[model samples]
Target: MLLGVIGDDFTGSSDIANNLKKAGMSVGMYSGVPDNKIKLNKYNAVVIALKTRTIPIKKAISESIKALEWLKSKKCKKIIFKYCSTFDSTKKGNIGPVIDAIMKNLNVDFTIACPSFPDAGRILYQGHMFVNGVPLNESGMENHPLTPMTDHNLVRWLNYQTKGKVDLINSLTIKEGAKSIKKRITELKKSNVKYAITDTLDNQDFDLICSGTDNLKFLTGGSGIALGLPKVFKKKGMLKKSNSKLPNVKGNTIILSGSCSLTTNEQVELYKKSNPSLFISPEELIKNKNYHNEIIEWILRNSKKRPLIYSTTLPKKVSLYQKKFGSNISSKIENLFQKIIKNIYKYNFNKIVCAGGETSGAIVKALMIKELQIGEEISAGVPVMWEPEKNIKITLKSGNFGQKDFFSRALKKL
Candidate 1:
């Protein structure tokens, strides 16, 4: 099977390609366009990774089909259009046209799948795999490289969920129920509902973020900055000066991120759960020699004077609502967002580092209730975040921040 990746914005395209190659797939990777053509006979599957923000709705639609036409010209039958879920926190830019282009022009026989649920299925394109809309059981692929799509089997997997559950969606007149699982986001604010969110290449929302408030009491995890970044900072060094209005490292501050299954509200619950997954460890994260406490303990012991926090943890779904949807989720999910806003004082110590635009954006959203002034994020990551929000200063960095064994060549600024 042949695989091709397009686009490089935010390091998303690379993320998918790397994941696929790790699975032992023969994948060809490229960034941007201008070359316009590839020998299709050499490959079976093609992925077009476009940054929805840079390419507007119209351009995305037109160029997406242009890509498909090029792929078809190469006699390639299977084409996958993948997009990154990340962008500036402002939520500007729309790729619906890209999806719409696929839906409208794609051959009925052509298989398509959104990159969501990356862990549940085979990533024919990246993390999970799929072919002709069918997910391959990676384990079973050795014997049956191509699994026949039986009607019943297809039906079964469509509604499949973790464990012994199925997300069956029936025709009209059938509604599902959610009686037991409860949401706790209401405590955050009015946004309690969690819904999958998408960004369109529009500047209105970003304008709102930039215009709404300033002088924000920013809060974020070290991972978003310390671990998630370092791509761009690799060259400049840790203490390099930036043009952003806000300070890169908030002195004597410690922010936590990670724990994918956790949510924003759940993050606050870190102090309550006693299990401490926000700044601590989960079952899977503790396997390393550090046991997920390397930075946490270090900070508690050695961070009495350090100004900037260099720790990280992935975000997780804390409450039931965050588990089902995500930040893009609705009021039932977002309500918990307000909790962060009102509870800002709980973390007010020195400075802040709302890392990861998404997490930082949420913090900004929460603080809006109080009229806080937030500094802007400075863009600079090597692979990821090449372009960040304008007006606001962000320290952009590549996704592989902590990967480097030593300091970067540009650390002379320190």
Candidate 2:
């Protein structure tokens, strides 16, 4: 494979895979670290999606290292450690620790940490992250149940979890183009800076960042960093342009939402107004053993309306649940969704549209989906993925992605 990507979550994996495929490179997005026997020679890039975003630090590091070694075994020319554009992680991070482990494994001294996806309204400026013109701390992310981003400054946030020194690459030098950005990187290295949080204001900045860091062995960023990479490989004769077609999937559609992000809440509210919607609560999931069965029956009964089974709620409710039941409340919901998905598939409700990274990860794992063919984009960072072996198509969407009418729009696309 020309490039091997390690995504921190399922939706983010599909996000970057979508970008690479749109750039005309054949991409394979695996649910997790694939077995040794799966052949990957036909694709230019492979993305290993992991559920390490909210896991324990030590386990996350170990899993990330294992993925890196597997990619190396496949003889990948380069590696991209992809995460959310919002830079989702705690002060004791899976992001910083995982990056450290990968760097140690590769023996690479310098890499860029640029999680800027302007199309999604996420940008890094002066080393601070902003979402939709609002500071990250002020964004709904501050209320995130698992990894609440209370700090807008990424350098400080990352430094809390990594051992290396972190620095910034401001927009002024980036505006001077690739040559200037390269010089700045060289200077930063000399000063013993390990990670540079790059400034990106728009999509054009992605080209300069990709060109400037062309020589590096490792890169850490959101899917947007991949926007210019296929062209770089093409210029070097490492890639050929081709069109990607979606598979013709025939089945009833169902939307499962577990994200409580502000955007997701809006989407759920808007979608439920016209669709057959069922709200699954943490209380019911925890207290009732037969809750998943009820959810499955509801979806099968309302199959023609493109039913939505959601656990999405307001931030206050999420905080209350976390406080009352501890952090495992999220896991309970995920487990419930896993059961529902496994049961629903037997009935031909195959077009699964998932919101929330954790929920999507659970569905992929429950279905034992090892590999996915990246298909056409449904939104900026989300795409329709096909599992040809099972004749199933799914759209894994990050909680904060898609428009308010995303559920309805995504169902139409599927």
Candidate 3:
């Protein structure tokens, strides 16, 4: 049976996939599936791993609905499992964990707050098996029931979560943050069915919903942590504020901006033609309609064995929205983790490497994995191994570990 795992990220999905494979299972994982795109028929079962640092319940549930709709059309029996992005959200959201509660509300299969691996992106486990937060076999593994995620784990996790189901859809309980977000979202949903972050009611009251914006702006700011937004991102003024005393920059100090999701205008089209096919994937991924789904399908099609590149320039104001997203997103632990986790997962990748500290910390904290063990004994960075019944290992970093050539160097290895 083929198991599909989807996460708010790519690395976490990979870790679990690696574990499942080690446990002897056939798994296919992918992350960052654009709405209304991708075919689920390639795989039988499906899993959704919510990254607290990247995706929130508001976003995950919404995305899950879209994925479920597509899956149902493709005859996929989905068992969405809400796992941690490695941060402890109990005291933050007034809800429990983040993902599971949504599952409970959506009436999905499983939901629970699993521990996050602290290692940045290193495979930290061997011969271990965990299904539904329980050991499938004793003494054959060296890892815990729950896996942790780093900035490096997001890609792999997303891949594993969506490709298949590794265990029975079940969980013990939900965390407070999960409860809070679920409640607030539920209330909001009652008033508004669409979870999209646009509030047409008021000018200043944009929904600002989505997993990415939530973490970069709200949760990260609330923690008072100095996360550096990618330098490549060049957004405009006012839109880029900082949580610090003076400038309340949305994400860490650095941000990857100055890019657009699609091309329009002359300048955008110019860049689009220049970069024809950076990444290519299976054709089955593009079975959906619309540009959003088109992009996701394009990504899936381009992700076979090639690399998925996040453009630095072109489309003009892509960075502007990111800055807007970072500035306006709610400042709370739950919100920040939700956005960060989503960022990590939504971007599909197999082997993830990091070059930021705040990103690393956020990934570690979101998953709630304590033993990340950095410095000294940590030669190749820390890792939060979520070796479920799949075969994927996630590497993590503090976001600035690889200096400037981080993403490039990592790509070479891939």
Candidate 4:
């Protein structure tokens, strides 16, 4: 593979894979670290999606390194450590620790840390992350059930988890273009900075960041960092125009959402107005071992209407449930969705739309889907993925991605 990417979660994996595909690179997305026997030579890039975003630090580091080693073995020219544009993580993170581990494994001291995706309303300025013109801490991300982003300053947030020094490369220098950014990187390295959080304001800034880091062995950021990478390879005569088509997938569709993000909550409400929707309560999920069966029956009865089975409640209810059942309530809900997907797929439901990172990760792993062909995008940072052998097409949407009509819009695209 020409490029290899390690994503911290399934939704973000599909997000980056979608960007690469749109940029004219054939991309394959995997649910987890693939077996060594699987062939990967046909694609320009391969994304190994791991459910490590909210995981314990040690396990996240271990899994990320294993994925890194596998990619290195494939002779990948460059590696990207992809994370969410929201800079989603706790004070003790899988992001910083995983980056530290990968940097050590690669024996590289300096890399960039940018989580700016302008199209998705995520931008960075002065080393602090913003969502929709609001600081990250003030954004709805601060109430994220799992990895609440209470800090907006990337330098301070990442520094808490990494042993190495973390610094910033502000937008003022970036506006001077790639050469200026490169010069700043050299200065930071001389000062022994291990990671530099680059500030980005718009889509054009992505080009500058990619050009400046073009020669680095590894790059770390959100999907936006990938916007300029395929062109870099093409300039070196390493790219080809590969097919980015999808099989016309027609079948019974289902919407499964487990996100409590503000956007997803709005999407769920908008979708519920016209579709057959069933809300999965966390209390019932923990109390009823056979809860999935009821959900399956409802889906079957409402199959023609494209049923939506969601655990997407308001933040207060989510907090109440978490307080009553502990933090694992989200995990329990995700497992419930997994059971629903596994059961419903047997009934000829081939087109699946999943919302939320953890929910998408659980369902894909349960299905044992090893590889996916990247297809047409449904929205910015969201695309329809095809598992041709299984005759299934899926679109994994990040909780914070897409507009109020996203759920309905995604089904039509599928």
| TM-score for each of the candidates | 0.30, 0.98, 0.31, 0.98
- Global lDDT of each model? 0.29, 0.90, 0.29, 0.90
Residue range 204-271, candidate 1, lDDT tens digits = 22222211111111101111111111122223232222222223333233333221221222333433
- Stretches off by above 4 angstroms in model 4 are none
CA shift of 411, model 4, Å = 0.8
lDDT of 2 by residue, 93-149 (tens): 799989999999999999999898998999989998999999999998998888899
Supply every candidate's count of residue pairs whose N, Cα or C atoms clash at under 3 angstroms.
Answer: 78, 0, 139, 0
Best by lDDT: 2
Q: Which stretches of candidate 2 lie over 4 Å from their true place?
A: none
* Global fold similarity of model 4 (TM-score): 0.98
Whole-model alpha-carbon lDDT for candidate 1: 0.29
Candidate RMSDs in order: 20.9, 1.1, 21.9, 1.1
Worst 10 residues of 1 by lDDT: 173-182
lDDT of 4 by residue, 72-138 (tens): 9999999999999988898887888889889989989899998899999999999989899999999
